[model samples]
Target: MVRLNCVLLIDDDEPTNYLNEKLIREAGCADTVVTKESGEEGLEYLVSCAEGNIALPDLIFLDINMPAMNGWEFLEEYRKLDESIQSQVLLIMLSTSLNPDDHKRAEEMQEVAGFIHKPFTTITLEEILEDYFKSNGN
Candidate 1:
C-alpha cells in the first residue's frame, strides 16, 4: 500500500476538523492528520516541522474562512518560505463556499494542488489520490 506521508488540515471549525480527520483515517488515506484552527497556526506548524528536520506533510487541506488568517493568507505566507522547504509540500484548498471567485483564485495559484468541497468522502479522497498520483507519474 502507498502510505500517505502526512495531511495538514487547517480549518477553524472544530467539528469539521474532527469529522474530516476521522474520515481520512478511516479511509486509510494517510497515517496522520494534523490539524490547526487558524492559518497562522498551520504555517507555524509547518515552519516548526522544517526547523526540527521533521518530514513535512505530503498534503495540506486549507480552509478559506477563519478568524485571523484565512486560506489566502496562509498561501501568501507559504510563498515567502524558502523554496526548498516549500517545494516539498502540496496544498489543496477545502471550503464550503460555493463562490466562483474562490474557485478562480485557487485555480490561479500555481502552488495550489487542487480544490476539494467540504465534507470530503472516501470516494472523493480516493479520486483525489488517484488523480494526484497519476498526474505526478507515481
Candidate 2:
C-alpha cells in the first residue's frame, strides 16, 4: 500500500475523531493523522502549514455538520486558497447524515473527491487508499 504523507479528520465529535485516528494509525494508511474539532480550526491548520512552509495533508475527511463553519462553508473558503495548495489535498465528505440532499450537495462540490458514511473502519480506509493511489497512478 502507498502510505499518504498525512490525513486530516475534521469533525466535531471527539469520540469519532479518536476512533478514526486509531483506525488510520492501525491501518498504516498515512504517516501522520491530524484531527481538528471544527472546520474553522481545520482551515486554520491548513493555512498555517502553508505559511510555515510545511507539507499539507494528502487526504481530508470532513464532517458536514459543525458548529460555526460547516463543511460546505469550509469548502467555500478552501476554494479561495492558493491553487498549489488546493490541488494537492483531496477532500472527502465523511458524514453520518442520511440526507440525500447532503450527499447530492457533496457530489456537486468540485473539491469533494468522495463521500462516505461515518464510523470509519480499517477496511474503508484501505479501500480509500487503494482508490486514491490507483487513480493518481502512485
Candidate 3:
C-alpha cells in the first residue's frame, strides 16, 4: 500500500468530512487528512503551507457547492498560484449534483483529475490510488 503524505478535503458538510476522514484513515491511505469547511479556507491552507515551509498535500478533494468560495471559484484562484505549488497537486471535484453541465465543466477543466459523485467510497479511493497515484495494484 502507498500512503499519501497528505490529503486535503474541502467540503461544507461536516458529516461528509467526518465520514471521508474516517474512511481515509481506515483505508491507510494518507499520513494526514486535513478538512476545510470552505474553499477560502482551503486556499488559505495552501498559502500557509507555501509561506510556512510546510508540506503541501499531494491530493485535494473539493466540493462544488461551498458557501464562501465555490469549487469553480477556487480553481480560478488556484490557477494563479505558482506552478511549483500547483504542479505537485492533484485535484478532484466531489459533488452530489447530477447536473450534466457540472460533469461537463469538470471534464473540460484541465486542473480536475476526476469528478466523482458524493459518498466517497473505499473502492473509489483504491481506484484513485491506482489510477492517479500509480500505487501498483493497491
Cα lDDT computed for each candidate against the true fold: 0.87, 0.91, 0.93
The segments of candidate 3 whose C-alpha lies over 4 angstroms from its true place after superposition are 135-138
Tell me the lDDT of candidate 2.
0.91
What is the Cα-based lDDT of residue 131 in candidate 3?
86
The window of 10 residues in a row where model 1 has the poorest summed lDDT is 129-138
lDDT for 33 (candidate 1): 89
Q: Model 3 residue 57 lDDT?
A: 98
User: What are the per-residue Cα lDDT tens digits for candidate 2 across 99-123?
Assistant: 9999999999889999999778778
The candidate, 1 or 3, that scores higher on lDDT is: 3
In candidate 3, position 15 carries an lDDT of 98
lDDT of 2 at 15: 95
lDDT of 3 by residue, 41-90 (tens): 99999999998989999999999998868999999999898888888899
Candidate 2 Cα deviation (angstroms), residue 10: 0.4
On lDDT, the leading prediction is 3
What are the C-alpha RMSDs, in order, of all predicted structures?
1.6, 1.2, 1.7
Task: Report the lDDT of model 1 for residue 4.
Answer: 83
Error of 3 at 130 (Å): 0.2
